[model samples]
Target chain A: METLAELEPGKSPDVPQVLPPEPVVEIKASRTWLALNLKEIWAYRELLYFLTWRDVKVRYKQTLLGVVWVVLQPLMTMVITTIFFGKIVRVPSDNLPYALFVFAGLLPWMFFSKAITQSGSSLVGSANLITKVYFPRLIIPSATVLSGLVDYAVSVVVLIGLMIYYGVGASVHLLMFPVLIVLMTILALGVGMWLSALNVKYRDVAAMIPFLVQVGMFATPVYYPSSLIPEKWQWLMKLNPLTGIVENSRAALFNRPFDWLSFNISVGIAVLLLVSSAYVFRRMEKSFADFV
Target chain B: MQSIITVENVSKQYRLGTRDASYGTLRDSIVRSIRAPFSKSQSKKGNGVETIWALKDVGFEVKPGEVVGIIGRNGAGKSTLLKILARIVEPTTGNIKLYGRVGSLLEVGTGFHPELSGRENIYLNGAILGMKRAEIERKFDEIVAFAEIEKFIDTPVKHYSSGMYMRLAFAVAAHLEPEILIVDEVLAVGDAGFQKKCLEKMRDVGEHGRTVLFVSHNMSAITRLCKRAILLGDGQVLADGTAHKVASSYLNSGLGTTAVREWQDLEKAPGNDIVRLYAIRVVDEDGQLTDVVDIRKPIGLEMEYAVLNPYHILVPNYHFYTEEGVCAFVAQELDEHWRTTPRPLGRYKSTVWVPGNFLSEGTMIVGAAISTMDPVTIHFHEQDAVAFQVVDSLDGNSSRGDYAGHMPGVVRPMLQWHTEYHVKEN
Candidate 1:
């Protein structure tokens, strides 16, 4: 009865003499557009960890302040923006203290911008690894994005201090903070993968990223609130995925009603960018070593 | 048994100067695409992209536990094939299949960070070379011990001397235990001790029933280490057989020999103001130009040069090297007439003879030079001017009498031997 149970269709009986076959790796010229090779990425997760750690360690090697710089960059930028716009130009902050209000928005903004900037040029910078070693090329930009999370984690502490100083209480909406973080990371990785792959062929992308990030800041309402924009133009503002992220982050912190419409839009755009950019990145990855 | 590796008609084509495309910019590409339909000539040019097929229909198979040497001159696509097998680059056509993990050492310290400590770099480089983190951790102490940098393990590699850096990098690479190992010419660097350690490590890997594909320019190393070899010529496999056979043929290939070299244009010949080299050739006892010499017969190297300066006492010399790159010996003209006396300005031919059974059986590369030893100023020196094959036939007459197997030496001199018979009666 046991032998009969084991004799299933398409199942061969075990052979005692022969060893089990090892995994066969096939190399071919053509690539299926849909083979994102997420399983291989999972297999190399430790390499991703090591590379991300290397990026974090090397970034602050020669710097005087080291990790303090991570906290200082966002803090100082928030102070300067608050003084220039909140004090001089009298920009609105949704009836909250301008510094605390902008700090919340600046948290996700800094991570997104810094991540994209680093990852856009990540492939070109790792030209040696790409040419000499065999690993998923997606891991390069992905490591850049992952490393930025450490910086984001440190910068989040400053937001905590600001909320307490402004007497802003935590609420149920704060649970959405984790969700917003995921959405922001997905968007950054997507855009970054697209840019990094393109940067291999077109170096002009590296030079253009910082400028584009600067322009994107003004467009995303990091210094001001979405309500500050006129009613008719607000819809266009929501088109920028960041607008929903920044606005909803404040909504969650300030205990306002969650903007499900804008949140869903952000989710949609993030997934779309991730899928499409992954497609583009995988399609162009084989030629990266040659072009780089 | 299934082959561990199967490469089928793999080819790679690289566009020359691809980065310098005129339409690299998006605006130019857009404009070109818009106008491509209107102008047949512009479309036909196809952006004028020139390409070279780096590998053309290369095919081979490797059984499990086989150690194969890949030998070729530069630009023969040896590195290209290795790169494709390593998955670093995709072939333009065809495919390959590997049945197990492959670790390729295209370079030492490929991902080594200068700012990282030696200890950190070991793990990082090991991981980059396709070793698991646990595997590196397990072999950590052994690696440090092998590199002989235990005292400075915590110090950043940027501060280590160049030799120490190379040793550490090689040590980490040596510990990679993969099912298939593909190594390039990394043995070319490092000190003799380090290179010997690498060779021993590779031998150990081969003995452990793993497959290895080694590429090296050192003929002796290839012949000693690999049992079989593949020779690539002009991006195609020219020969594939036993290591000694392929290596010897590679030495006799185009770059290794013609047995003759001549400078037709005097102004463009190799020389200085005092002398000019006209020709160099391998000659036999009959004084006829030849490239192959009997192992038990004398061989002569003839050099022709014009002495432009009459008052310079010139010493003409010849250098012989085995195909393994060992300098066999140097012979300087010792004729009393020209030893210390200067000759009048005229064309002169000097020949040096190497006696029978002198050079071992293999290719001998000859270099010719003339120098004045007052301050040792060389008039002209032509390295690899000519090369010839020393053929040892199994005729039972030479030093290797009746021995059909290989003989290992730089020289095989036939020494006089006498035997005295002894009888014991009980």
Candidate 2:
């Protein structure tokens, strides 16, 4: 057989004076243990942005209330919980107004739950992109999680309004609010990535996430303060990662003392889950196109 | 001088039974895990576990600026190899090295949201296809113009017709510039004009010294766009050479084209008691059986059948289809002596001679049928009874005459042209 070079007459015309350097890519058959390849992820950051923007834009396209629903969703839930627990059950609100106290906890809880539910099924939802193109598979779930931040950001306005109505003043503890949000985001990303990866294979993860989130609300300190738990079972509540973030968020909002032990537990578990879940996600990502 | 892409010993294995949706449930996984230890001996016996090798030890090298066509029938591992090269799917065992960025167009409008407008989908689809935001912005106008949807750019894709959606999707994909572009049957969609534009864009990419790997069932398009072709069968490269050579190999290998077919038993033939198809064959001018015919020579599709109870005005017709499955034309026995008269019960032969320079170069599959026109009753219509390869000549005598490039058409008839030069005496 004649080589292509021989079949053609000569070199291609308009060869540039300065040729761009071509990057060499090597693909092998070995199993990937835990290669994050963060550089590739960074290179595709714009795709992550577009995907996130698409999700955010399409989420409320034809809805009548639109962004109002973002604030209304958490606010209505906070009102019912405040009425049921604070008025009927006489749950202590740690000397703060019941509305402000529960609203603060609800903020982080809503963000985490929405992120998990959306990101858990994200891989299955974007199976078209996964099977068609080449990019970091992690971006699909990451985009969904990031899009939830839009709703979270919008709901924060209601938190500030409730604090003002309750005459609660901001304290220096509020400086740690952003740090607590970061920790919450890390935890959400961890669980979201794990569930999304497994959802590619099991598909039961999608069905089980809503129930898990429902159980998770009571497990965390979203409706009631962590102080409501008796000292005997306080260790069990401390085991929940969201317990520290939610409680600390409330502390930051209402000038309550920070729980150093629970905060450190949240930090430890957040980082550990982030690392381990990322490893699992990368391991399962290779076969995602086949199964998803 | 150096090759730009190298694939070594690539193979892919897919588990048989677990491909469907019912297999991947959580309970199934849990049960499998629980039964893993106890079923080890049974698994070792290999009774239930079944796998098929989609690709097996395939290897090739491509230099820069080469356009290669991968041609194969369904389930022939062509798409699997393209997916592996595009990095969308991982091979079971292999190594691949590439020297530049690779762009793969496996499907158009992969992540398009129906709620998003055409303009929004352009950017979104471009990013999903691995184009940067800046690059999409740079070519935004060109994409809209190519799609011919400037007026509807701001309209939601859900409201736009599917043609407009496909056009916008293809426009974005067409503007993507990568060192190596791998396309898999993307040209199979869109109308004739859109497909022509896409083919032109592909040729432009090839001319820019970018290596291209095109997988297509359209033989004419494959021969038109690619200079080299690879024929794949049963997870391996069956032939790799010049485009025409590999295409003929693929066509004559009983994969795409069948030159002759015969029904040995009349009782089991495809027909009722009226008539039955006996045999169908493609023959050259010399009346000899042939699978490949010269473009400048007439070829006949000869059908021999038994007229069992024929007092019917039988129409022996041949439906010719290109390799792309587009019907070229149909020919019936109109000038036969038995056209007005009823046929007596006997075996008869009917031949339809397709004139030289009438058919374009590629595989032509002929479907033979015996039908009556009054009520339009088809006795026996074989879908693909016989097929032949029409080879275009490079000799300046043919219609394409010295161009030596891809001429897009279903027929390449040597139409008459007359020109008169008017020169003023000065």
Candidate 3:
């Protein structure tokens, strides 16, 4: 190998007396919005994978229960929902077993909620990395969403077990599970990207996510069937993208006719939200390292 | 060779304030949106925001294969510039055109998960640094061998010692073969041996016709590994040129000679009633101010002082501090020196000689204090009278030896050496 000395002679002799070049692309947001450069993010896709894997590993490291926490979280939530909502409140489960209904709903809800919560705080949590190094800012939030999938997968197994115990036979519509999962993930990532970017500048978002998720759970059809709502109020229920997701998940599991209208609406809204939120996130990404 | 990276007129501006609540609250945002057109002028005036530009019109170009160092004091926008190049943060203005893949080791273990085994973290870090899966797989053995953590590669990184973790993290980062590599001061934390090794590796990477942008506080390393350097001060490029000259300028500015006097003023000088110091100087035996001090010859510290009282006992003490701020030695004048001596009313002089072979070649500071005793009662006292530098010739050569290049710690003591002849039984 050549020594650094032999490679270049004049460049390191003194501080080069040169001026900086003029900026080519000027970033102008509300001046308050983060100016994320999406082009840069697309350039560093490999980094996103490593960060996602890191989060997955770090989450289970040193824990006695390890990956069991992934399954246990949603499982425990399922038990509570079965006792409180199923027995106490007596919420109608649309002729399906209440435990299985809530479990199915909880699967997507948990994935979205966990992804949102983790991604929202990811920027601040990785302050050291943000400050010291340069990589696509989007990777931080994207990795959080991807890592949450590990837990989502674990929780899905519990749902399958519940279906077996309830003696519910699998239906052909069950093939739609992959599509629903993708829709749920995209929606979660959409909202997560917005929240994470906001959280970097406004810490209140970090503090408010749990309360927002709690309110969101009731707003959607997590514990009750959307059908139970009077038809007049049904339109309002359909407004929540998750309502369509949960109602469709039950339809697929029970061989019921797909709610093509609500399903299409949810897909449309999810795509819209994902696109807008991603744009907003990229817009606000420029100030992340500074504000975080 | 064509330029691999071209940075043109880049500047980043930041607005100082908390995020507005209207954007977060859907109701408030809706209300504001409805009223936006009507109250645009009012809201614009009420915005109450201020903007500060962290970087201003900075530009540079790197040839296909070049190693450049970025040097600056804290908050000089060096990190910001690197972030823009690494694509971690966007510049408010300007553009960076690059020719090939870029890998950055912005911080050591940047993507390491503590729960992940050392082996897993290697792949993760490699991927984060832009290595393909197959590329990392091919370099896995080399990385493990270089890290020297084969025994613990399967252990979780949270359990690995910091040294081991750093080694593994650096190993993965070093194997990256991108067209350009950006590294920050993560190497500052490693042991001296590891630091030297990393520097050598960085030099080798640069030598292999890859470009590198290095940021560090270690002037020696910058001079050794980078051909060119950019000096940033207060978010602007202050200088950019050859590494040695840029480093010298940075050191001169950072380690200003005048600052030494300010430091002396801050520290208490050693003195009491009988004698107090006004100034202290380091001089050779001939009393000339010299930069080089012989390790084997006596050097004098002449202290000029004033006497306050004639009836008290006074003792003088001298403390020596090394470049890394470690106190290496101290000398004191006993009460006997002042017991029978007449108390001079005004100004007086006292000189102390530090015998040769007593100090190592490095920057050092001297502090002196004077105090009086009346039946074990204490009087005036001051510390850090003056600071000085010592340049000792090691290995009987005027030029410092290569062995002294990367030793750790604040002191290098020259101790006794012995040789004996012995016959080995066959």
Candidate 4:
């Protein structure tokens, strides 16, 4: 039992083993509606680079397949989604091949979910770095988001292969893909910022997040297409920003007409959350070293 | 010179034990909010029951190139003051303004990733210690040289020896050339040689005109590094002046120190039933107790113990160590009568005199021991049981010869030198 307790994460009493990885710092407990400091984050941009680099390096250090698992993770998930929802449930694929449909939707969902899960726990995981140095605290979770891009790129290669197998090609409308990626990242960052901050104070969020992400996978159309849902309820689905991203990821993969209306709403909500959640993070950051 | 750092009326208050349960869920927060109105905390009048003022209304100014030592016992706010100066944590009230780029070695190896190679960790740890990328690149060779890990620069630090790891950490910290350096007991790690090297590096940093705020409980180190010292007690500044004056005062003000210590309780005495230590003392030749012994006079360490089961040959010994951790000597009862014969059960007293003009002027920690060499076993050993100061008048009769510029030695024994008149012919 003693050994078991010692094996617990964040239980190490040593200095270095217990602090959160950090890249910037500010001290204030303000009541301001928004307190995001772009300048501070800008100043620590090099540290941000190192943090992202550290995460990317440490992730695959000892794994036998190394970075191959990056592509493999999404590929396996896509196959499972194809079997369960595409074959058994027989979700409508909007005149597209079922394999192609599910993979496209899974790409954005995978990116968003991985980014959110990693970044959401990033602050708490970086307990060792946070307590020791003075850096912009926002960099930890943001760096997590940045590192997820590596895995996302690997998975995108698999997606491109699926596209070729299905004989689908991209048009100029595919240019919106990067914009969609950016919106998805911002959405992840916004929620991740909120969750990471809350996780610092109440670690119950750490236990709650994986369950939420699982439920969120089903809520968003990863395997099933949005068209399969009735039209009346489709408006409510758009409120979840992942719905817009996954649908457009499919459109971008197939070069369909961009849904500018839902896309605009999604980007707007993403930007709004990114701003406000960053504010909440900054506000709580003052007591982070004290409490974390 | 203008002051490079100014702090005024700084105080830090912390809630005791609040950290454990501070991380409650959203539902708990909601419950707390709903119960707030009906709570009776207002009737308690904010009396600070759970509050601890780690630092209270403290103020100081540090000029560029002034190395200041903060001396205190545990929980005396030394660390809190250093943290505030480093901006690691903010004071509850008041403000501190630092004029230049600040670097702090609050803990060594702040972010040395064990998975990374030594070379990579150098950059990572350097950046964490406030070195920019280019700055680290420039000092790369010097850091490797200082750490003496050039051969293993490409190896992962997880495989390095603990000493090597500490050297790498301290090397990165020591190489940081910030305008103001803040350190907190970082020298406490590493071996003695490494500690000496670190002190030398800190001395070099001081010579480069960087203002330094060094916090430490190591008084000898405090005296060696700084010209000024601040003594903190119970969250307040008790003394602030020259390093020698303040350091000695801090030592004198500490608890659990005396010229004599006695244990009357039989069960609590520092020994087994076979032999229980009754008392120990630092006494002058007249047997009167004293802490300060002159260089020309022999001082005595007296020990009295009760022997229950006799017919056992025992050695009453004391190990003396200087404050700088140099062993002075180990003395024990080695009389021929006691060496070859057993004694009857009775109370025994022993006094060992440190010869006159032997010890240097400083504090010496005495460790008392009672042991039987037949089985090579120690019955009892008390580390740092008592300590005393040695003094010299510089009257030209003893080792410190009428000259003084910080006499350096573990033993200042007066030695004789002879000169013959026949030497004039040469």
User: In DockQ terms, which candidate is top?
Assistant: 2
lDDT of 1 by residue, B1-426 (tens): 567888999999988866456215556667888998899898778756788888999999887667889998788999999999999999999899887778999999998999899999998898788789999999999999999999999999999999899999999999998878899988867776777777878777776667789998766667667878899987888899888778777765533346789999999999988899999989999998887778888998899999898888999999887754568999999988898799889999998889988888877888899988888898888988888878676789999999855678999989999999889778
Model 1: DockQ vs. true structure: 0.24
DockQ of each candidate relative to the true complex: 0.24, 0.32, 0.24, 0.16
Candidate 4: stretches off by over 4 Å: A1-34, B17-22, B38-49, B255-404, B412-426
Relative to the true structure, how large is the alpha-carbon lDDT of every model?
A: 0.85, 0.86, 0.74, 0.80
Highest TM-score scorer: 2
- Model 3, B1-426: lDDT tens digits are 446678888898766553333234444456767877899876685475766777899888887667899988777888878887777677788777776667777887876777788889888877766778888999999999988899999998899888898899899888988767888887776665776688888877877777789998656567678879999987788999988677667764543111122224313544543555567677778887543465566678776677767765566667886633457887777557476575758776777887765676545567666654455543443444454544444455422344534334454455665889799989
Best first by DockQ, ranked: 2, 1, 3, 4
lDDT of 4 by residue, A95-189 (tens): 78888887788777877888888888898888777777777789889999989887888888888888888899878878888989999889888
The interface root mean square deviation of candidate 2 comes to 4.2
What is the per-residue lDDT of model 3 for residues A1-292, given as tens digits with 9 covering 90 to 100?
4458567622443322232243322322235554455776776777787788778877887689999988888779889989998999999998888888888888888888888988989988988877656566778888999989878888878778888898988989999888988988888888888888878766778889999899898899988888889999988888888888888988888778888878888899889878888778767666666666
- Residue-by-residue lDDT tens digits, candidate 2, A114-226: 99999999999888888889899999888988899888988888788878888889999999998998898888899999999999998889999999999998899877778
The deviation in Å at residue B41 for candidate 1 is 4.3
Candidate 2: segments with Cα more than 4 A from true spot? A1-10, A14-23, B20-23, B45-48, B257-358, B363-409, B412-426
Instruction: Please give, for residues B302-359, the per-residue lDDT of candidate 4 as tens digits.
Output: 9989898786788999999876566789998988898877767999889999988889
Which 10 consecutive residues of model 4 chain B have the lowest summed lDDT? B40-49
User: With candidate 4 superimposed using the best TM-score fit, by how many Å does residue B337's alpha carbon deviate from the native?
Assistant: 11
Candidate 1 or 4, higher lDDT? Answer: 1
* Residue B117's lDDT in candidate 2: 94
For candidate 2, what is the total of clashing residue pairs?
Answer: 0
What is the two-chain DockQ of model 2?
0.32
